[model samples]
Target chain A: MSNEETAGSKPSEKVIELRLPSRLGYERVAMDAASSLARRMGFEGDRIAALKTAVSEAVTNAIEHGNQHNETMKVVVLLTVRDDELIVSVTDQGSKSIDEAYVSRVPNISEAMQKDDKGGWGIWLIRELMDEVEFTKAPGGGNQVRMVIHLER
Target chain B: MTTTRQHIIEISFPSEFGYEVIAREAIATFARCVGFDRDRIDDLKTAVSEACINAIEHGNKKVHGLTIDIVGVYDGNMLQIDIADQGIQQYQVAGAPATIEEKIAGKAPARGMGLLLMTQLADEAHFLPDTNGTRGNRFRLIWRERVETLEPEH
Candidate 1:
């Protein structure tokens, strides 16, 4: 079972895609799917947990910010497993420009806590847990946040 | 596609995790009507979920009988969503750990990520406190359709 053939367009890669309604209930579905994929990629313990958290945050962001809790909207999650890396991309139909969504620096924790601020931490966790994070405008005007976890690390 | 008239939808529901689906689905439908593609729609879904969940879990703390109000507006190529929760507790913002070692310490709670996801997923995300005591915590998310030049008709 460990040596099962990889699936997808490329022989060495496997891809799993899901289109879910923009609902918090569906977040669990994405998280579970991501956890299973991470496990299949031989991730253990903390790495698997990290992957799950990252995926949850990403999907949650999509359903919340991208779709604005609009039921008619759909959140698409794509998981690609390659020999060296696991890449997950969560795309939403939001019109936010990529330049606007990108955060250049990690927020300072003490300052944020001092103000009693009540939000602004999901992207940082995604950056910390994943090896590489990219935000781009998806085809047809929405945004896509792509996170990659290197298997060897 | 562009429209001269603006469309607005408003809904209020209890601050429970279950009701978050209603908000997400409504926003998504509006986004689709505004002509957002699959990828953009997904982004809207995640961002809205983060905002709504934060309001339910943290802002209202799942307090019984509390409500979260959602307003979605679509104008031309722009979509705006506002989620407001009754102010029960002060919002707690999560800051980044100073050191990578501290970040890896595994002691930090996962609550802080909601705000970060909001800013990253939406074009503009803002948190407004109800200083006047009328509204609660108001989280606003805005996305604008990029104007693409069409190829000249041959």
Candidate 2:
């Protein structure tokens, strides 16, 4: 969202916030919310699908790793709809801090296939699907991932 | 976020028109995961949309900075939704709603249709007490599961 917009220039920016318990199936709420907003903004079918996938991976990561399956912890998903882009930020109330080195490393397919658990592709998938992605610590002490997808007019 | 088996979700959005669709979509997906059939999900969406509209138009008076809060919980046999709004104008605890013929004959305005729809679509829809240390008007909607589903208990 921009800091300044002339009055009566465009649709007012909106924000939808969803706070879900740190559970697996609850992530669908975030995904569906984002998909609805993106579709309303005229995002294409493929982009909406991509947005849902990216949102699912992000929320699933928040539940599985960030919150470590502790149902007491909550995963907060903020969807900000601007005139030109949709910004989604997923924050988890986790005690674990995110490692910077691990965030940027690209996983090799061969290496991942050799391991029993072929996971760890979430961050990479989000990075690939979203137009812009950033990971930072929440101001209130949690891990947050903010992803932005541009609306092609 | 309690330790009990109930699955609860809390959502809040700016008090504006058109955002209710997003809330409807979110809850529809939740209802599906909680084992509601297609017809029931559609009814839930309509009920949620009407309630959110009432929250925005009446409870918050369409104030831009104000927000509407929705909390949804699904226990084993019941799905309950609580839609709360900042009490700009207290909801009138009045008598029964107007009849359809009264509105058709221009005897009553069509303003009460939203509430009527809410009560009809949801199994139970009623307003919570506006007092007792609470700052807003809270409306609650409950839908009970008629037949047990195979979905695992939360």
Candidate 3:
């Protein structure tokens, strides 16, 4: 595809669908989609970069911790722009419980904790970068992490 | 005899976002001193920002009257940044077996993805628990030579 051809391409008014494989290499693909959506929504510079960082962090969570890099599973990123707010919903097929209290609480101990961290830290970063973050489950079944960042006017 | 021209900057902030800003300025200074390219400097800034933000938000989380220290070193070609915060050590987020989407859908919970981004952002990233057991967190960001000139533009 030519650069002009691609640049002229517009973000679909409908939900932009992306099927990211459950692998480490597909991270860039996901980041591109998220950043493209952010720019199209008129997010400039730092705000755009912030959106990319948040999106990448969320997708990385989906791949490494969520899907456990399961080959059979797939990650779906859905983008929707509402006014000055950009809403991103990333869904993946994994079975686990969503604990809001656990995700938000600050860790209070590390004496017995190993220096080499085994797991933990993605969601906290997301909350820090985005204006608002929430974890909501669909009635049908699946995990949905909704992240919203309000673009500056 | 072999010598590497590495410059170090120490910035101390008291519960302020200045920690992040100073870290960035230190990076720009180190990059110019080391003669790194524009693109490379930008990359270093992004990676450094992520690390500094992590330390301020996670390490200093609401703790007042604490200082965050950042040191930038330019080894002729490579750039190394060390940022420290004296706060209780904890994984900002937990790693879950389910993806973030799944967690948001209430099917599962999201876990430690921040560390992953930090690792990917920089060439080398590692966290060291305070060896003195004072609850200090030290995070490092390292990258290779990015350019061949070290001149500042006026």
lDDT at B100 for candidate 2?
84
Q: What is each model's TM-score for chain A?
A: 0.87, 0.92, 0.79
- Candidate 2, residue B138: CA error in Å? 1.7
Candidates in order have lDDT scores of: 0.72, 0.88, 0.63
Q: For model 2, how does the per-residue alpha-carbon lDDT over B1-154 read when each residue is reduced to its tens digit?
A: 2355788898988778888889999999889888899999999999999999999999989877677899999987999999999889887556656778998999988768988888889999989886666668899999998965798889
Put the candidates in DockQ order, highest first: 2, 1, 3
For model 2, what is the error of residue B121's alpha carbon versus the real structure, in angstroms, after optimal superposition? Answer: 1.3
TM-score, structure 2 vs. true: 0.89
lDDT of 1 by residue, A1-153 (tens): 122242224655545555666766566656765676576567877998998888888888887788887766767777776787888888988775544544556777888888866467888899999999998889967779899998874
Task: Give the number of colliding residue pairs in candidate 3.
Answer: 28
Q: Candidate order by TM-score, highest to lowest?
A: 2, 1, 3
TM-score against truth, every candidate: 0.47, 0.89, 0.43
lDDT (tens digit, per residue) of candidate 2 on A13-116: 66789999887898999999999989888899999999999999999999988998888888999998887899999999987987898899999999899999
Against the true structure, candidate 1 reaches a TM-score of 0.47
User: Model 1 Cα displacement at A65 (Å)?
Assistant: 1.2
Q: What is the TM-score (0 to 1) of chain A in model 1?
A: 0.87
How does model 3 score on DockQ? 0.01
